[model samples]
Target: METLANLESFVRSADHGSFSEAARRLALTPAAVSRNVAMLERNLGVRLFHRSTRKLTLTEAGEAFRNAISGSLSDIQAAIAGAANGGGEPTGVLKVSLAPTFGTMHILPLLPAFIARYRGVRPEWHFENRQVDIIAEGYDAAIGGGFDLSPGVVARTLAPAHIIAVSSPAYLAGRKLPAGPADLAELDGIVMRSLQSGRIRHWTMRDAAGEQIPAPLREVFVFNDPAAMRRSALLGLGVAMLAVPDVIDDLESGALIRVAPRWYADAGAISIYFASRTLLPGKTRAFIDYIVDAFKQRRLAERFAGSLG
Candidate 1:
């Protein structure tokens, strides 16, 4: 009989691309993981992995088996976990990815309340600027904008990602303000570059009358991180296009001022994403419900909408 231990070892090893990595994740030694995998292969009467000194690749049979059993294994584990906890409350580590500035400014404040409500649940969150492969990296959830909807993942809209032009009061003190998107060509521009493509992004600003105009910016400084760009704008380096959520506090405090009030860009919706599983972990489920409800209660979507003054 193939035991659950053997199956878990095989799956983790395959997912991690090495027995050592799998053992690290499973909290076991490499030799033990190898033994479990060997036992599994002997029980099945077939070799599952193509092992080499430098690489371990799944064979055709192994790939087919993994595909057939992966989903069922997740469901079975979720079931067992549910039964073990008596369906009471979630008890486990919830791994999540979040954007650095937005997550800290908004979501981090909600953590105290969340911990008070679900004491059994522990959060292991990472703040970054890049998109993560949720399943492959073992992340329970991620919050961001413009993420590609990979297979077996779902998303909920948290807010509209409305982008607008901003500059520090000092930077605009002596400079003529932009009357329209086209007028921005004369001012120094702080621009964001794509991390994946290494190209500067361009924006087409839209007005209340539904007129779209391409922003003609003279790029004087470039940054890959939005937070860095915001800082640069605050330092009076140049005008930058930033999401409303990122600049709302600065705008309210008079550190940053809107350049073209009549123009904003629709960047897409900021969303929370998680795996689409039939038997989701209680921790994950609770987080999803809590966050969705919080967004609705806070009316963050309306606040994030780029409204002209």
Candidate 2:
């Protein structure tokens, strides 16, 4: 394999017009520079520089190779330094921004366990319901849901958001249960209006053919909070599209019934994202692993399954 050190030697030798001079500049012997350049040329099976007794000049191939190698060498050097610092123990404060419902219900329950595992890093978390600029807000990491992340961010999937329509059996007992997605129009429902938007959040569903279709829901009561809508649905008010965890208790206790399978689409996975330009500290990487590990080891899988049913 060709070494980056050989490419560096060749680049230096061409610039200074002599192997001896380049070696002197790089604190190496002339023979070392010659071996590096020779090995590089042998590896590529092409001459990089035309050599003579009087002067040195680049072959057409030499100029092209130098241009490619120069930029890559700079990047390699920078990556090495960054990896060393970024992969080591993180000492400074790590700032994270996460969604409110996810932060409160999912991530917050996960923090203490991670904190207990790694003692070297301290995290400062900011939770908000409204969307904000991650860079402008100075957050190093962010947890986002079904929303599309900005072009400048690097995203990784954490878990999925499976929003389902559920209602109390008391509410559906005498009433006709919607057999199809369109039938939701005939049922009384508690709709969640997005606080960001003035309109109510519609119940969307899919079929075995993978067609995603939105079902028009007649809103008997509109609420901004899913938790509140879940509360209303529990009292036998109406069916509501709620996050799985929000209704896991009621579903397990046989208090709520899953409604209209046609409206339940493929799972929409929630993601954890970070600024692309920023290098993640070791602690940040570790925390991501730690959270994923806890998700598996803990009964999160069982709970999610029970909730989904």
Candidate 3:
């Protein structure tokens, strides 16, 4: 019988198409992973991967074997994790991916309380600005907006991903106050470039009265990251459109002032995503519950709604 380690090596190698990447995920040496896979292939009496110097390609039999065992393998791993935790108490490394600014501002603040409550679960968080594959990358969960729901993953919304225009008080001091979104074009704009599309992002601002207007702020500065755009706006360089959750504290502290207060953009909901497994690991479940409950208790959903502005 193949050991779990061997199966894991094979699956992760197949998932990543590289022994090095699988080794990185499994915290094993590339040689070890390759050896484990070699052992599995020897035991099965069939070559699984067509190996080249650059990448590992699955053979027909290997593809069939992977398909046969992928779902069962996930369930087995989850079951093993659940069993290791005494069937209830959450204990393990909780790997999570999060958008940098939102995670630092909102989710990171909740960590102290989370760790205090579930001391057994150690958080391994990656603060990044891109969407991650939850299962393929071995992430327990991820927090962000606009994730394409892959198979075997579910998203639970935590707050509205509403966006609003903001600027430093010093920058707005001498400028004419905008009455509507169209007037924003007269001001210097701090804009974000889409990392995926390589285009400057623009939004249509909508009022509660159902009126929509194009926000065409003069593009004086452009950045690839939202955090940089927010920083530029905070420096009184220009007006920036930023997510409410990101700039809420700055707005509350009078560092950033809302421009055209009645107008805002509806992006979507900020959501926590996890695998839709029948047997979820206790640490992941605990994290999901804690974050969902905290958001409700704090009423962050209402506060993040840009339409309320």
Candidate 4:
């Protein structure tokens, strides 16, 4: 029989592709995790990982074994947590992944109230720009847009990720304001380059009247991150197509103004993602409920809609 620690070490190591990260999550040393995995491999009589200096990859047996035990391990952990927390109270570290600017501006404000309400739940948040593997990486939840719904994961949409062209008032001072999406081509563009593919993103703007037009702003500046693009737009660099949620505050504060106000692009929905398990952890449930309630109270979906522009 395999010990729970060995199984946990193996699964986490596989999820993160490194023992150091697994050790950090487990609060064990890398050497300890490595030894636990070694012990498990010896008992199983098969090597699970193809260990290399740069990467740790799962063998065929390792992948199959991990798939077999990962869900069971999660369930066992959740059961243990439930029993320890008196079966109801939301307790333990609620690890979540979030986008940097959006999380800081929008979600972080709700923390005080959340902590006050659920005193036992501690938030462990990672502000990142990329989509994370919720189950594999052991994240309680993730908040972002355009995530592929992998098996055993589910998403609840919080807001429309409507993209709209924006520019600083200073940048538009001497330029002819765009009358429509087509006119946007005359202005200098602060465009986004996809970090994943290294390709420039092009958008088609839609009006409230259901009219669509190609948005081809002359590319003057390019960035990989929306926050960086927002900063550049603020510096009077050029017009940028940014997610409404990311620039709502700036728009409200008059730091950034919508270009071709009648038109916008539909990016997708900003969603909260979590593992789809039969029994969710109390902390995870509480966090999800709190965030959903917050979005409702704030009417973020309506506010984030670009059609309103």
Point to the candidate with the largest lDDT. 3
- For 1-309, candidate 4 gives per-residue lDDT tens digits of 899899999998998999999999899999999999999999999999999999999999999999998788878877777888887679899999999999999999999999999999989999998988888777999998999999779999999999999999999998899899999989899998997889999999999989999999887998899999999999999899999989999999999999999899998899999998767899999999999999999999999999998
Which is the winner by TM-score between candidate 2 and candidate 4?
A: 4
Angstrom error at residue 23, model 1: 1.5
**Candidate 4, residue 171: how far the Cα is off, in Å:** 3.6
Candidate 1 regions exceeding 4 Å error are: 208-210, 307-309
TM-score of each: 0.91, 0.64, 0.90, 0.85
Cα lDDT computed for each candidate against the true fold: 0.91, 0.72, 0.93, 0.93
- In order of listing, the candidates' clash counts read 0, 1, 0, 0
Error of 3 at 164 (Å): 0.5
Query: Each candidate's root-mean-square deviation in Å?
Result: 2.1, 12.9, 2.3, 3.0
Q: Number of the top candidate by TM-score? A: 1
* lDDT measured at residue 148 in model 4 versus the true structure, 0 to 100: 95
Q: For candidate 4, which ten residues in a row score worst on lDDT?
A: 80-89
Tens digits of per-residue lDDT for model 2 on 1-309? 779779878877876778988888678998999899989999999999999988878899999998677656645644664576665554445678877766777788877767776666688998876665654344667775665576455677665566778888988988887886777778787898887878887756776566666777788888987778888998988778776766766777988878874456445666677655434456666766676677778756556532244
Candidate 2 has what TM-score?
Answer: 0.64
